[model samples]
Target: MASVSMKDVALAAGVSQPAVSYAYNRPSKLSQAQREHILEVAASLGYPGPNVLGRSLRSGKIGAIGLMMMDKLSLAFADPCTIALLRGISEVGELENVALTLFPLNNNRLVGRSPAANHGSLALRGLVDGLIISTLPDDHPAVLAVVKQNIPFVVIDSPLVDDSFFVGIDDRGAARTQMQHLLDLGHRKIGVIIDRLNPDGYRGPIDPQRFKSASERIVRERLTGYVEAASAAGLAFEDLSIIEAGGLDSTSGQAAAFTLLTSNDVTAVVACSDVMAIACMKTAHALNRNVPQTLSVIGFDDIPEAVQLGLTTIGQPMVEKGVYAARMLTEQLNAPAGTRLEPEQKIFATKLIVRTSTLKI
Candidate 1:
């Protein structure tokens, strides 16, 4: 096949080389009729216009961004909460005409690929102009690789990175509110379930010392809030048991629930997510333990399924967080080369939505 060049289009349209270039890239430099004629001639010659690589190299921008996550893309989308966040991100990406690339480090393992192997490729290949980390731990290998590469990134709901933008909810205050609800109901025997204590999915009773990692910032903050609220009520950490779920899904929630229910006499349970709360409710139902009667459950993230199941949950603006994070990244990308913008910490508020899943115990 013969390759069509700008020279061919210029000769066919009777325009200079610069005029042909202007017609495709700098259209304002040419009259409307001249630009239309040049495009029509280029179409006739089977020219597909300039290569993306050529355009990107000339502009010093890729017109795209990458989103990093440790979980599989399929599992990430399964949760409506994550779907909401993706929706917000796509909304801005569509409006700004930017593409989004997902990097799920764990799934790549099946094909003998590791995030470390790809991290270097991303830098050398220029896969994206910027990056957004959804929920990597503070010291995650992927996070470390990105930091080492000095890529522009925003951390969402994880360890607060120095000189990096962060977007998250006031998890501690929100957890305290939910814990107070259960505590106010005369339920001192409360249990807590965290989706992740460490990146390894270590389930079972979490050691008190294990809660100090910045990687578990969200979990630590929420537990701290619960402890503070309990202390204000003249209660101690010994009054409750804390367990880490096996995974981020409902099965993990079920396991955590069983351990808490069988091991202790908890009248109420607080889960870190509505998905986990739903799983605990199912486990309770299977065990013939009536909800709000034998056990009351409260979860974070008021996902659509939570409303359908009448689950009492904490509502956070997942979509808004995504939107704000993407906007900050875009702003950073558009900033002057040497301009320094102070890192911004944006915290969204959470609300307690009372539903059938929780009640006075």
Candidate 2:
């Protein structure tokens, strides 16, 4: 049997070869109706469209985007916040018929090579048209490699770089607002549980310098916001009890909550994420402490579980951030050469979602 070609599909559809190519490679170049007709005709003729690999080589454009996260791919799928953001990105990618690939950092099992190193090499080699980086680490090797390659990309939930696009919330302000809710509830002694402060993943008692040099911008900024809010309420920064969770999971949350609950000074706990807040609530239950009545708890991200648990939280537009980030990458890819693809840094507002977890003393 003979294989189908662009010309065959074009002739069958009564369109030019370029029109057929535009239907698959650059749908934006043709009118919606025309593109739909070309696609339908090509499909009817059993033409699976152009070979992505061959088309990419010919046109210098790949219909795919990469999303790089600091954590493992499994964890990314498990986290509600990450999942929401991914769903948003997926929606945009679906519209453009673009594949969104997950790139993990530090694949420890791949001999001596790191996943970050591998992903960086691929980015530099132009494996994907663009990238959406969701990690908070500023100096990540993967991030630096992408920047060095001069690929169009966007950073989500992280600090804005002059050369890259960013879509995120004001972490410090969001943290401050959430923490203030606890303070307003007459919770003078509040404890905080956070993920690691540095790339080294040190557990427990992060020093001032380590905090200052935190690779995760969100963590540093949120910590600063919490400190500022606590200070305004007459609480000294040093006086705020802090617990470093090894990771952003319920197990770590439980451990941090146990430590904080055992302390005599902490009457409230502010978890950096909803997962941790839920764990804290579980810990409170284990300790026979009534939430709000004994220990008020607040969280960030306002994941669905937070509302179910009646935990007060700071709600940021996670899905919207992902959508905007994906859209920015798409625009960069479609833009003309020498066109400044630098999208203005977009900061979504965060609102305080009050619930039953907090109450005035």
Candidate 3:
């Protein structure tokens, strides 16, 4: 097929080559009539509009943002929190006509690997003008991959790099606040369930020594929050068993809860996520334990299901986090080339939602 060119359109429309280019690249340069005539003539010549590849090459942008998460693509979508976050990002993408591409990377693929061993992230080169990565250690391979790319990016569920944008809630603070609720309810023997303790993807009770030396920032932070609150109330950290569910979702939560409920004589359970809380509730039900009466349960991230169950939880602005992060990226992207962007670290607030699932015992 003979691909139509701007020159052909210019010839048909009796305009200069620059005028044809202006019609597409800078429409304001030409009068409306001239722009209309150029469009009409281009249509007559079967010439498509501006070439994407050529424009991207000349403009140094691909009009897309990449969202890289540490999970399988299918699995990332399974969590309601992930969905809510993506919902916010997509809203910005739609408004700006920018594509939001998912780069679902497994733990082995993204973290703890050398930058040279980061094969997965290298694939992102030239794929997106910006990246929004979630939850990695400061020295994670995925984070290194983003650093090497040297593009505008926003960090979520993790710490911010210098001169980059970071959007996340105060996980430690939220965890402390949520755990305090359980403590205030007069629950002395409480259990804590976590998705995972480290990037190694290990499941089970994390050894105290290993937990102390662990690099899993998210897990460590939340656990610290719990311990801090409990300790402040004169409760020893050793009194509570922190169970690593080893995966993301209600199933892992349920399995972990099974161990805690079956063995431990706990009065309440604090799940790090809504899914885990749901699992705890299910486990309590299967064991015939009445909720909020025998085992008061609390969760984080007031997702739709949590609300439906009237579960006491901590509500983070999931969608708003995504929205604001994308908007921050958009600002840096829209800035003139060579303009340095300062680091923007934003921590959204998390609220406690009192519901039927939690009760003063």
Candidate 4:
């Protein structure tokens, strides 16, 4: 039996080889009827279409982008904030009619545990045209792998390493504003619930050096902003009373709230995210503490639930961030190498959404 080829398909379909290739690789180049006819003929002839690897090599485009996340795919899907960003990315993808491939990092390894550990292998595998990585640490091993591969990539809510493209809010400034809202309300005893600083996922006292080393860009920036705001208002860092949450969710927020609210000296709680802040509210209610009167609370990221709960927070454009990231990656994939996009660091502004969650003391 003779093997089927593009030439064979073209000859049978009554079209040129280039036309057959166009029907498979560049579908838009052919009329809809022509493309359908070619596909139908190829399918009847048992041709499986063109080789993707060969097409990629010839066109220098994969028509797809990689979206990398730190946590499991299930967790990423569960988070509303992450979902919004993903929706934004999907919108752009829909417009371009390209697919987004999810590359999961094997969590079984000890030394190479994180998604960063396997980034090099994934990037070198030539599965994606570019990468859009969402993680805490900008210098994570997986991120470095993307860099080593020299693949066009973008970072979202991570540190700026080597002037790569990024889409995020002003972490330090937003944190400062959020904390200052509590300060202005005369809530002196403020407590903070922060996500883990290190990739090892330790939940305890944050050592300065280790925090510096393991901290993602957003975490460090927001912490700095909170610290700065506290200092400016004459509140000592020691008095800030920080609790490190194992993860960024309601459960961790509630646990942190339980610990902080139990203290008679604590009057206000500042959560890093709306999910945590709302969790703190639920915990406070369980503890019989009246919100805004006995304990004022503030959260960041004005997710949908935040507004309903009247939770005061800093509103970062989550959807826009995702959209911008997708746009940036697409642009990088389309652009020539060595040419940087305009405004490499796309920083979105945040606003303080004052609601019923906080009150003047």
Number of the predicted model whose TM-score against the real structure is largest: 3
lDDT string for model 4 (1-361, tens) is 8768777888999987767766754456689999999999999999876543343455776666787776656767777788888888877633246667765442333116454555446544777877787764555666767777678888888757676888878889999998999999998888887776655666655545655675656667787888899999998777787777767667777877787777547889888888888988999999999998888989988999999999999999999888888766655554333445443777899999999989998
Tens-digit lDDT track of model 1 for 1-361:
8787667777899977656656654466679998999999999889876443333445686777888776777876786777887787876632246677777756544212444665655532577877888876656666666776777888889867777899999989999998998887888888888888667767888766777753667777888888899889988777768888857877778988888788888889988888888888988888888897889999999988998989998999999988888766765564434556567788898999998877774
Candidate 2 residue spans exceeding 4 A from truth = 1-58, 93-96, 108-120
Which candidate number would show the highest lDDT if scored against the true structure? 3
Q: For each candidate, what TM-score against the reference?
A: 0.78, 0.80, 0.81, 0.78
Which regions of candidate 3 deviate over 4 angstroms? Answer: 1-58, 93-96, 107-112, 119-122
lDDT of 3 by residue, 20-116 (tens): 7567544666899999999999988898765533444558767777887776788767989889988898776333566677876664543445776
Clash total of candidate 1: 0
Clashing pairs in 4: 116-142
What is the Å distance of residue 70 in model 4 from its true position? 1.0
**Each prediction's whole-model lDDT (CA):** 0.77, 0.77, 0.79, 0.76
